[model samples]
Target: MSRLLLVVLLLANVGTAIGVVYARHLHRQSFIELARLEKTRDELNIEFGRLQLEQATVAESNRIDAIARTRLGMKFPEASDVVVIQP
Candidate 1:
């Protein structure tokens, strides 16, 4: 009976050790995955900033006015063409 009890205790200790190793492996894997995600997030943030700058440059009023004048041949109305109506 005493030997049987010793064998059970030894088996339990081995099982616990195996569990500890598996837990450590999972912790390492999670750490590596977190680092990879953080790097991807930083790269996306940089790309977002660049896109915002490009959008601002493209939406400038001066650039739009230049395009309108050159491409569409749009011009401001002359004073003689202005008609004032008193209502």
Candidate 2:
């Protein structure tokens, strides 16, 4: 009876150790995943900042006018080219 009790206690200790190892492994995996997610979030934040800057640049009316006049060679129509059509 004493030998059986000793064997059971040893088995329980071994089981508890295995559980601890498995728990540590899961904790490590979760930490690695959290790190990867944080990296991805940082990349997205950088891209969002870049896109916001691009939107601001594109939304500038003066910039559009400059591009239209200087690069596209657009000009205002002459008075004779304008027809006064009112509803």
Candidate 3:
């Protein structure tokens, strides 16, 4: 009876060791994946910031108005040139 109890205890210890090793391996893999994902996220964030700056520079309303006034010779009409059109 004593020998049987010893055998059971030994088997339990072996099972526990195997479970601990597997858990450690899983944790290591998860950390590596997390690092890779974080790197990708950072790169995307940089690209997004650059695009935002480019959009602001390209679509400036004040610049468009300046170009229209200086280059196109367009002007706002005076009260005489204003036509009263009603539908």
Instruction: Give each model's clash number.
Output: 0, 0, 0
Q: Which stretches of candidate 3 lie over 4 Å from their true place?
A: 62-84
By TM-score, the better pick of 1 and 2 is 2
On residues 1-87, what C-alpha lDDT tens digit does candidate 3 reach at each position?
999999999999999999999999999999999999999999999999999999998789888788889999877789899889899
Candidate 1's C-alpha runs over 4 A off are: 79-87
Candidate 1 lDDT score at position 48: 100
Instruction: Please provide TM-scores, in order, for all candidate models, with all chains considered together.
Output: 0.81, 0.83, 0.74
At residue 29, what lDDT does model 2 achieve?
A: 100
Indicate the residue-level lDDT of 58 in model 3: 76
Between 2 and 3, whose lDDT is larger? Answer: 2
Error of 3 at 18 (Å): 0.6
Model 1 per-residue lDDT tens digits across residues 1-87 = 999999999999999999999999999999999999999999999999999999999999999999999999998899998999999
Task: Please report, in order, the local distance difference test score of every candidate based on alpha carbons.
Answer: 0.98, 0.98, 0.95
